[model samples]
Structure formats: structure tokens, C-alpha cells
Target: MKYKTKSRHIFILMSLLLITSLVAACGGPATPAPQAEPAKMEEPAQTEESTQTEEPARVEESAQTEEATTEETTETASATDSTPDSGSVELPEVDPLAVTGDIISAGSSTVFPLSERMAERFQDEGYGGNITIDSIGSGAGFERFCVAGESDISNASRPIKDSEVESCQSIGREPVEFRVGTDALAIAVSQENDFVESVTLEELAMIFSTAETWADVNPDWPAEPIQRFIPGTDSGTFDYFVEEVFDKDEEPILSAGNLQLSEDDNVLVRGIQGSPYAIGFFGYAYYNENQDTLTVLSIEGVAPTGESAEDGSYPLARPLFIYSTAGIIAEKPQVGAFINFYLTYVNEEVIDVGYFPASEDTLSVAEASLLAALK
Candidate 1:
């Protein structure tokens, strides 16, 4: 009987020790228990004073626990050290229905279709207010936004010129630029014309400036008069073309014979499609929209695909932009909301509208610009 009683006491003591270890392991550093660990380690069921024989062991364990806690805290602090150097800016997701009031944006006949599509989507997704996007040329658009100060937003196929910036400043506005997408200028001709599939840079320049007939540009072709259709002087498309082909000199192109110019790309498109001898150039989206009736010529043997445009392989690829002042955005909260929505969802709509999406890095900069303006 004595042996059985001793065996039962040993088993109960071991079980108590196991439970005490588990309870100690589960205790968190934040929980107040300075003396609890010492007490538990020294005695399973007795007070600290009654189990003083193991006091030294408890002290050592308490010191080790403190050291462990210090190490954990150091690790946590290192993990949370966040100082931004460079990356994407987080833009707020827009709920169009929650946005109110009218937004007026004008400029860039090239960007008009993309902006129009976005506005349509804003309305389709429950935006209740008005969004007016005018299809005037980029220069004319900036004139309205800066010199006239009648517009809340100005869209451009090119960056705002220094003079335009001064105009904005004179009106108590500092323009902010947001890069939205890239466009590869499409040189197109009527599909009925099969004489040329591509043209070199040298030939392209003459085709618009000096060449009066198809045979003037290339031999072994019919000597048909070269019907030249081009964007008007105020158009950003015209400016970009002149910069690329004429080294920014407009005299040659302006003096060319049989030249036709218009701010409307549709008019240019219709003119180019009217005759096999006709040729013109405009935004890739315009060519894409009228592809069935037009054949887009390759420049220097390189065509304008999304990849080519994004990679800078296409010679005529150019960045598209929209300009607005912080004052305008702040005064018209609706304009700010619309721009936020534009930056947030442009990639989803850009490709379908016939332009390539801006690179992620470029788009992030635009988002950062908007955030800084809002602040």
C-alpha cells in the first residue's frame, strides 16, 4: 500500500509540472506577470517563500526571458522601418456615382476619342454629372485652358510649351502634366492604293513636303499626283510630325502643293480614303478605326503595334498628356475626381481606344503628381 501511494504522488507531480510549463509558454510579453514565472518555476502548488530552494534557477530563467523579449522587440522595429524611396503611388479607388458636378476638358483631337470613351464609362457606371470633352487641337485647347481660363482641364498630344506655361501662370495657375498613354503616328493611305507598303524616313519627309507626284517619291510607279492630307497648324499631330520630319521647320510642309489641313481627324481620314492617290498621317487610333478603308504604312520597315510603340522601336511614337492646374482641381472637386478616375482606369481603356498604355513607371509618376496637387 505504501509503494502504490508513492507511485500515485509521483505521477500527479509530473502532470502538474507539464501543465505549469505550458501555461508559462502561452503567456505573452504584454501580459503583466513579473513574479508569476518565478513563482510557477519554483513551485507547482506552493508559495515562493515555501519553495525558496530553487530561487536561483527562477532568477536565471527570468533574465533569459527578458533577453528574448528584447531581441523580439529589436526584430519588430527593423521590420517596420518603412521609408519610401521610389515606387507606385496608391491612388484612391473612385466610385463615379459618388462624384458630383460638371467637368469640362478640351484639347487634343488625337486624345478626344479616348477621353470620350472614359466619360461614357463614367456615366455608364452611374456618374450623374456632366463631362464635356472638346475635340479641338492641342494648341487651341491650351489657349482655352491657359490664355482664356475657361476650361478645367486641357488635353494634349504633346507637352505644354513654355509660353503656354507662362500663360497659365499669368492667370494665377500652374499647369500640371499627367502622361496618359503613347501613340504611334500612323501614316496611312487608301486601301485601293497598293504601290507602297512602307517608306524610309527620307522618303517620308519628301512625301509630305517636296514630292508632288507618286513617281517623284519613287520610280517605277504611276505618275499620279500625291494628294496630301495633314493635321492643321494648330494640331499637336501636325507639330509632332513637323518636329520629326522637318526638324521643327514648318515652312516646307506649309508651302507644299496640294496640301489639305483640318483639326478634325475624321475629315483627314475621309479625305485620305477618297482616292488611291491620297495619303495622310494621324494618331494610330484613327488609322485603327478606319483600317478597313485605309492601309497604314510601315515607317522604316517597322509597323506600329502596341509592343513597338511601348518599346520605342517605332520612330513616331510619342507620349500623350493632359494638363490642369491645382487651383482648378481644388475649385472643382468633380474635376479632381474625374482625373483620379482617369489615372486609375486608363490602362483598361487605352488599348481599346487605339493607344498603348503608358508604362507602369510613367503612370505611377502621374499618380504621384495628382496626389501632390491634392495636398
Candidate 2:
């Protein structure tokens, strides 16, 4: 019975084994193969981390670069905006007939004739406004224009003094200098005097100062008393003379005997023409106007000609200037118009008035000054 039972169990085991083999053949495997989903999931996680961190950092870097570029552009624009206008400034044209209002100018006696001529022409061209010009000395002129604030313009032979400029500022005015023409300071003697045709700078200084007689200056000259006629201390001409001849020391010339000082060049001219021993120095225009009675002495072998003055060869050649404030120009439109006309037509009348026209460069600068005042 035991052997029969063992044989039956072996048969059943053999049948079960055959069934399992058939199932394994039909399906591939009972347990599932390791899934690729986990590796794919890890890849997505890494990609998300890169987008959140590394990609944002790159984007942030790009944003920073853009910000730097914007700052650079702003700085470049600022730098450009701060630069001064160095290009040519356009001068406005004047229609004198259409303008109206009074204009007052006072200053140097040397600039008086030129300013007077311009004023006449402005009126002749149909300007209806009254233009008053006073022939006060430069110091007095500045006193009126800067300190008292009475004049619209100030005429000057020499540059404005710092103290005068400060005075202008005290009255809410900033004086602007406009170069109008050039003048040679004429050292003249009576036409009847044939002894001196020229003089050295040293001899010229002595004749105006220490020398008591013509013979004291030169042995060949006659022993006549030196009659010295000079511009007054208030005159710009006086200031220039003292600066050039006396090393800015006025004591020598001021204390000299036979010295006569006048604000009017006409007075000096008449005084100088009275005697052969008489000598005086004033603007070339005064000498030119009275050339028949006066003989202009050459200094250091250089005469006061337009050519010599323009070329800077003449030692006493000086620039003639007119000064006005921007406030005045704006307050009086007629003043602006008149200055425009003067600057535009100055050359036409300057030569005829016995003064040299300012150089083209200088005229342009004058035009620029007018332009600035108008603005």
C-alpha cells in the first residue's frame, strides 16, 4: 500500500511540473522587470532643479548686465548734456526803425567818438529812441554804470578793473565786454616843432616825467620848457599811460612840473598844438582829427598806423571796448537792437572815424557777446 501511495504522489508532482512549464512558456516572467520610470523620474527632478536654480541665476545675470548697460547710457547722456556750447553763436539782426526806448552809455573819452558815430548812424537809419552818451572818464563811467547803476553801457579803452566788476555784481549786473575797434595812443607834439620826429621809449618817459626841458631829453633838441599835456587820472588813457610808461607809478608824472591833465582829448589836443615845445598823448582819433596842427611822434621807430596797431607792432596800440550788462539788454530791447546794429555796422563807420576796425576774430567775439546778452 505504501509503494502504491508513493507512485501516485510522484505522478501528481510530475503533472504539476508540466503545467508550470506550459504557463512559463506562454507568459514571459512571473515577477515584473525593474521599471525605467524611476530613472526617468530622477531625470525630470534634476531638470526642474536646474530650471529653479541654475536657469534663474543665468536670467538674473542677464538682468544685471542690462541694468549696467542702462546705467552706462545714462552717464554718457549726462556727460554730453553738461558740455558747453563751443560752436558758433548766431548774432541777431536789428531793425532799428521798429525799435523804441532810450539807451544810455557813458565811459572812456577815447571811445566817445566811436560810440557817438554809432549812435548817429543808428538814428540816421531811422531809430526813434533817444540814445544819450556821456564823455566822462572811464572811472566816472564805471561809477555810473556799476556803482550807481545809471548807464546802460560803459565805454572803455582798457579792460574793466576787478573792483569795478565787483561793483557791478553788487548791483545785480555782470558787465560783458564787447571789442569794437582798435586805437593807437598818439604821442603828439606841435606841428611847428621840427626838432623831434621820433623818440625812444626811455626818452618818451623822461619827456613826460623827469625832464624839465627838451634839451634834458636829447642834447640835439632845443632847450625849451617841456609843456606836458596828459589825460586825467580818471581816464583809462591815463591808466594805460601810467602802466606802460611809469610802471604803474603815477607819482612821477603826477608830480612833474608843467603837467596839465584833462578828461577831454580835445582839450589836450588844443593844449599840445599851442606851442612847439608842447607834447601830449591821447587817442589816435584826436590826433587824426587835428593832424594839421599836431605832429604825431614815432615811438621806438614805430608809428601809430592802422597796420602797426593791427599787427601789434606799435607799443601803445590798444583795444577799444563797450561794456553792457545782460540785465540792461533784456530790460531795454532797444539797447539790444542798438548793440546789434553797432556790432553789425561798426566796421563801416570805424575806419571813417579815424580808428582801425577790430579784427574779424575780435568782431565775432563781440557778436558772440551781443548774442549772449540777447539770450
Candidate 3:
């Protein structure tokens, strides 16, 4: 019984040893089971992610290119619609008038400024050709207009004398009258002369006529001999002054023999500016142009300005004129057009140039008369 029990114990021990060896051979506590790898599926996912990122970059680059194209197109459109920097615009090429010929105008020195301004503006606005203007005195201009058929237009500082109009009719040229503006025959002296301020119309007549010395008009004035300057007899300024002041018939003062006569207002300005005792009269534009050296004199306690002239406060104010030949208007449509432009576009410039624009009604009448004469 003892041997059999001992053999059984040995067998159990052997079995226990065999199981322990088998566990050790398979794996110890430090080693774990190997896991299966999903390499094929993971590889395809990584490749797809890379493709998605690169596609966004391509899309961003394409978007940038499209933006650049849009900007370029906008710039091109802006350049195409830009205005030219040159002052000349692209105006239609059309003749502005029916008649195209040379224009010759001569008239009052007073009207010369306005007429010349019209001619200049007309040429700039693309009139046919050169419009020549002569600043001959009014009487001389009338003589030229009346003798035969010389001047196309005559500017007169005064209304046409009946004799002058008759002379035009004798030559078969009917004169169509147009008033351009108003003027104040400005009397001026040296700016340095401060004592004499104002003068009466009667005093002006005395001073301009044969009154040889300043003391003759007013003993209170400078006892120095009055150095007088007068516009020539041919001047419309002379005619207006004589008619208004001397009752159209008074003989000139014989004492005025020492007076200086000049056809040019500029000459008169220099004469007055140089002499302390000198007094002279001319168009207001001359005084305005030389205000530094010449002092305009107020007449009868009234100053001469556009407002004053309009209100009739300025005693020396007078209407100025332009006389067009009826024949010229009928024969030349450009002449009529030029006249219309002068009355329309240049009225304000006329006043700005130191002459007074006529009333609107007067201008309308003048325009109507011009159109009628053309018809």
C-alpha cells in the first residue's frame, strides 16, 4: 500500500511540472499576443487626406488668378472712359454761320473795347476768320462808313447825326442802329491833387472851353494856370460833351486856346497824370485802367459807376452805339450772326470791361431790329 501511494505522488508531481513547462514555452508575463495590422485601409485614407489638402491649395491659386483678371478688367474700363486733358473738346464740325467773309469795323474809341472783346471771343468760339476792328474816332468812322461802302460796322459814341444818316442813304446804304452800352465821360485829374473833389456840369463846361487857367473857374482852386486837355473835335466824346453842356450851340471859351487836344485817351491820361494843375475828360475805362495815376472826379456830387449810371445819378452818362449797314446784314448772314452773338454772349463782358450794358429791353429791341434787317 505504501509503494502504490508513493508512485501516485510521483505521477502527480510530474504532471504539474509538465503543465508549468508548457506555459513557459508559450509566453511569459513580459510578452503579449501580436495584433493584426490594418495597413491597406489606413494607407488609402492618408493618401486621400493629402489629395484634399493639395486640392484646396489649387483652388486658392485659381481664385487668386480670377481676382487678378477682374482687377485688370476694371482698370481697362476706367482708362477707356476717361476725359481728355486738353482744353479742346470733340465738337461737331459744322459751319456756325452761312456767310463767310472778312469783317471790317471802325468806330468810337469808347465802343472799341466792347467791339474788340466781341471779335476776340468770336474768333475763340470758332468764327469764320479774322474780324478787324479800328479805333478811329467816331466822326472819322462815320466818314468811312458813309463815303461809299467801306466799313461793315461803325461804332459811335453818340447818336448818328441826321447829316451822317442822310449821307448813308445817299450812298444807298441804310444804317441799322444798335446801342451797345452806356458810358460816363469820366473827368479825371492827378491822384496827387486832393483839394478839388467835385465839379458842376456848368463848371465842367467852363473848365473845358476857353477857360485858360484854373483860377478862371474857381479862384479858390490852384492859382496856377489850368493845364487843360480836351478830346479832339472829331471825337464822339467831344460831341456828347458839347451837346450836353454847351446847349449844342455855345461857342467854346476863347480862353480855352491854351488847351491841349488829343484823339487818344491814353495820351490824355498821361497828360493829366504828369501835370498837377491839369484836368481832363475821357471814357471811364481809361480812368479805371489808370486809377493808380488818375483820380476820377465826381460830377455834381455824384460818382460815376454802373449803378449810378443806371439810376441817372451820373450826369455824364451817355448811351453808346454800333451802326451796321443794312446792306451788309442783307448780303451776309455771318454779319447778322456776329451781331447777334455780340448782343447775346458779350453783354456781360462788355460791362465787365468797364462799360455799362444796355437795358435788357434795349438789347431785345436791337436784336429784333437786326433780325428784321437781315430778312
Candidate 4:
């Protein structure tokens, strides 16, 4: 009756493994536990996410409690040691109904919304086990996974670092990746603002970093000062922004005037809503959700859209990821099943979550990688 049933199938699978071992000891061919056919999970209706950083679309919560959910309660996760295999392969199919056991993941606050959406769908499709998604910054998430060795999956907006890979190897866990979707880092202003509609990378760099007033960045603009709202230092969104716009230099933006930083996107949204001078950025899903109250500024003459993001027309578009190891998936089949369900259903959920689907080819590549790892 408890949430920590530890999964009924896991116990049965363990019995099969023991039988296989005994058969091997008797010099007979061992029988492996059978994998069920991939389950057909009904896709959830897409929900609109807020477009502004001042607010976050709420994730539906269930009243069911997790008192006995005695799974991995650690705050951080272990980074698994793994490498990329770029062959075109088939996506893994999973029977979500057969999957069980708790799933613990934490990472990029930017990727948090999409992951949360997927996790909810997994639960709705008859998953009784616990699933916890933490919105800690990606760097912190990596530390949890790579240094602490606690999570089953590490959600990230960017790829794992080389040093992170080495860290995972040190702990005997090989990190495997699954590309889930695409995000357009929407640079947003309140809908009340009319003077600003779009900006170039140079203007953005100036606005977020060095410029004290709107006039400093653009001669035609008002002399009003710019208000900056952004994700905190540990955020992958912050890292991506600095890398792309500041060319990896943090000083200019970090020391910028009238800046407020937070790990939550909603904080940025609210900060921007307070004044026409305010501006902030986060994933497009937030923008889409809050479309009524916010305006997403085009970058480099191209607005952030699913078409633009997938086709690479959007300058701020980037791929999203979740990292896990084959070893972990094998040991905990529930993780494998959850990932399978995620990949299979993400296209439907991604739009609802306020992001774009990766191209069929890209998704297939991710699926292929997962299928290979589960072996």
C-alpha cells in the first residue's frame, strides 16, 4: 500500500536473475527476464506555459503522499561515465505499465519545466512509484550527479562537461545521454513596453552587462535605465547566456547595474513586469505560458519559434538533455522505462510544456543511443 513497493516487477526480475545464475552454475543456458512490449501511454493534452519570467505555469500536484518512498533521498546525483555513439538507431520502446520504482532527478532550472511535464505524464499513465524532479541549477545538478552520485538522471540544458565525464568515470558510472527537446531562450520584456521589440546580440550584451541606460545601448531609445532580471550563477541558462552573448566573460553582466538574479524563472518574470525598463530571459515555455502579460523580443531579427528553433534560425535556440548510465538503468529498470516513456511521448508534451520538438532525425539519434545503452 505504500509508495515504496520497490516495484513488483523488480522483485520478479531479481528472482529470474537468481534462477539464471543457478542455471549457469549447473552448466545450463540461463534464461533472461523478458521485456514487455512498449506500453501505449495516452498523451496528455498540451497546456500553455507562461511566457514571462515573472510567473511559472504550475505543475499539477497529486494529493497522494510519499511517506514510504524510501528511495534515493540524496540531494545530489552521481555523474555516470559514458561516451557518445552517433549511429542512426531505433528508439527504445517501453511498456510504461510494467515500469516501477522511484525516480530521483535534479538539474538545470531551465530544463525543469519540460522534465516536470514529462514526469507528470509518466505518473498519469499508471506509474505508482515516486518521481521527484528538483529545479536546482544545472551546475549544482551536475555536482549532485557527478560528485554526490545520488540521482538516476541528471536533466541538463547543455551537454555534460569533459571534466564531468571524467568525474563519472571515477565513480564507475558511465553517463548516457538522451536529447529530449529544444528550447529558445526567450529574452522577454513586459507587454506594457512598446519602444523595444527586438535586439541584436551586441545590444543584448550591452543591456545585460555594461549599459547603464537604454540610451547607452541604443541612441534612438529612451534614456531610461535598464532593469535586469536573470537566473543565478549556477543556472545553465546563465551559463548559456554568458557563453553566447558575453563570449564566456561573466564580469560585465555580473556587475551590471540594477540587476536581480534568481534560480527561479518566475522571479525574473515578476521583476520585468514591474516596469517597462525591466527585461529578463528564460525558456520559451514560460513565455508561451504567460503570452498575455509578456513580450518575447526577437534576437538577430529572428523570433523564437518551434520552426525557428528546430531549423536553427533562432540564435538563442539550444538542445535539451537528460543524462543517465546504462548501469543505472539496468539496475533500476524503472529508470529505463521512465526514459523510454519520456522519449516516446515528449513531442506531444514538449509543445504543452512550452518547447519545441527536436527534429525526427535528432530524436531518432537520441532514441538509438538509449536503445544501445539499455543493452
TM-scores vs. true structure, each candidate: 0.77, 0.77, 0.72, 0.76
lDDT of 1: 0.82
Candidate 1 TM-score over all chains jointly: 0.77
Regions of model 2 farther than 4 Å from truth? 1-89
Segments of candidate 4 deviating more than 4 angstroms = 1-92
Q: Among all windows of ten consecutive residues in candidate 2, which has the lowest summed lDDT?
A: 45-54
Top candidate (TM-score): 1
lDDT by residue (tens digit), candidate 4, 188-235: 999998999989999999899888999999999889999999988988
lDDT of each: 0.82, 0.81, 0.72, 0.78
N/CA/C clash count, model 2: 0
Q: Each candidate's root-mean-square deviation in Å? A: 28.2, 36.9, 38.2, 19.8
Model 3 ranges with Cα > 4 A deviation: 1-99, 253-255
Please, what are the lDDT tens digits per residue for candidate 2 over residues 148-167? 88778899999999999998
Candidate 3 has its poorest 10 consecutive residues by lDDT at 45-54
Candidate 3: give the clashing pairs: 210-253, 210-255, 210-256, 214-226
RMSD of 3: 38.2
Candidate 3 lDDT over residue span 1-375, tens digit each:
999999999999999999999789765753643333443333321211222322324433433444433334334433552442233222112233322445667768888877878877777676654466767689988998887457778989998989998899998988889877888889999988877889998888888785667777888886777777778778899888878888775367324666788777777888999887888888887887888898889999998988998778898899888899766754544555577667766576876778787877676667666545644
